[model samples]
Target: MIIDCHNHVLATALPPGHDRFVREMRAPGHRRAGRLPAYRPATDEDWVGLEGDLDPIDPGTLVDDHVSAGVDRATVLAVAPSTYTAYGERGTIDLGRVTDVDGPLEVAKSNDYIASLTRRHPELIGMSAVNPKFRGVEWARDELTRAVGELGLQGLKLYPMYDHYAPADRDLAFPIYERAVELGIGVMVHMGTSSAKDTVLDYGRPGALDEVARHFPDLPLLVCHAGFPWVDECLAMVARHDNTYLDISMFATKSTQRQLYEFLLRARQLGCPLSRICWGTDYPGGGKPAVLLPKLTLVNDVADPGAPISRLDVANMVGGNWARFAGLTDWSEQETLEQLEAWEPRWRDS
Candidate 1:
């Protein structure tokens, strides 16, 4: 089964506005503007507004798109960017402003919306979002418990960079992790690469999750985007911790095909189990499964690869890994992973 592990079905009636790629280009130090000349926005009018598409597609249409694209399932999530992004940009929030803030109510409503989708559609696996800093950790924990125990959400997703907080903040993040562990649900963290306006890059580093991984050794922790631009650290973390996994969300595009393929080869060369890594498209955010799916097998075309990447390797990335992470399959019974363990890297000696 082909599954996209990261996606958002936007709220149709009251979908939130977004900070787009162009706005990130407009930001003072966005690297894409400097590194990739073709992407640099050339007009003053492009900066007129920070918000982009409202992304309001009905939940049914999103499912149909997945089905028509040959994707068997997708993991859907709720993120309240409007609730926290703008307010958290400066990296500081007044304690007085959080308790009675309207953000938490919106956050709850969004979680409920995802919960509804999960109940109605078997194809969509749902996850709830929480910003412990935007609302108190206690309240966030309570909501997480309710979301999992009652609403039937499969996991919890945290957006630290967008919300301006470090992932390892013991006081703010630890409690939420503890709660997720108790609930027996996996946690997906938005680590690595944020093109959004006013995001703090330091907060998105995957290394921050190291301490969290150690604290909760048995909890399944997924580092979203595979910490691109710092993928070595991400691969190292995944190699080091049995509990850590990766969701390679945004790197499967035409622009990044080679970079991602090379990284996976090196990761395999170093013995990082590919079974622990899952493919994610960041759909509704950015990705076309129909386009990106074929790119995953580009590795096999390497004529002199040390050990040719098999179709199973691509399958693991496409859906098998995620099936295990989402509890649809037994992680212990994964037989092909043994074949991956014996595989070598690139054939050429550099």
Candidate 2:
């Protein structure tokens, strides 16, 4: 089976006014959450190309495309942003995100949409989202419980930095993590820097998840984006913690296949189990299958010089790892080389 461990159905993935709010928040002299921008925006051009990013395409069609592309299964996460905090600062700020001002209703709606998608397509796995800071830890915990028990979501998706909360905060986030452990579901956390201008960079680091991994050993932590720019640190944490895994969403693409191969090679050298690494494309928003799928096989070409990443490694990276990690007992190794040999020539250079 070919499985995509990270993806988003844009229709319900983003809250209303999210794009407009973020644009307004980045205006000159607007007060941001953590520190000033690490790299401040120069002009509106910096935020260009985001118009299509928030478009609400049909989730069913999205799944259909994946099916046509030979992806047997894909996991979609609910996008739930936290309420903007009330702090003393002499600067301007707008809505920032619809969820930033509203309570947990949007989160529920998002999860409901995701649950519906999963129900419609058994090939899709749903992950409910929660922001412990804005809605209160108790509410977040209860929401996750409801999502798993009633909504049938298989996991939790968290945006610690974009939502302005310390991911490692024992009091704030631990309760939610505990709920996942009790519910027997995995957690997908957005690690590394966020493109959102209002996000708290201090909270976005992959190292903070180290504390979470150590605390909740039973909770499967899938660090999204491979913690890019901080790849070494992220891989080191995966090496240190058996419960931690990394997903190459934005990190792997046709243009960056060589870089991803090098990272995988480094992973082997670091003693990080290749089985814990999963293939993912942040479809509809970040990376998509058309731009990333071919690279999944292309990386093998670059995995050389020593203990290279084998075809088996490529298979595990694309499907087996996620199936095993997510307890997907039904997923089998159906995409054998013999079955895909016809497309092998198409996945190569002209």
Q: Rate the local accuracy (lDDT) of all candidates.
A: 0.68, 0.71
Model 1 Cα lDDT, one tens digit per residue, 7-49: 8675312222232333343354323445323566535354434
Q: After superposition, how far is residue 44 of candidate 2 from its true place, in Å?
A: 7.7
Alpha-carbon RMSD of each model: 7.8, 6.5
> Model 1: residues >4 Å from true position, as ranges?
11-52, 80-84, 87-105, 254-256, 303-306, 330-350
Alpha-carbon lDDT of model 1: 0.68
TM-score: model 1 vs. ground truth: 0.78
Top candidate on lDDT is: 2
lDDT of 2 by residue, 54-97 (tens): 45545666788777666778898777644453221211111123
Which residue segments of model 2 deviate by more than 4 Å?
11-16, 21-51, 85-107, 305-307, 334-342
For candidate 2, the per-residue lDDT at 295 reads 80
Compare the candidates by TM-score and give the number of the best one. Answer: 2
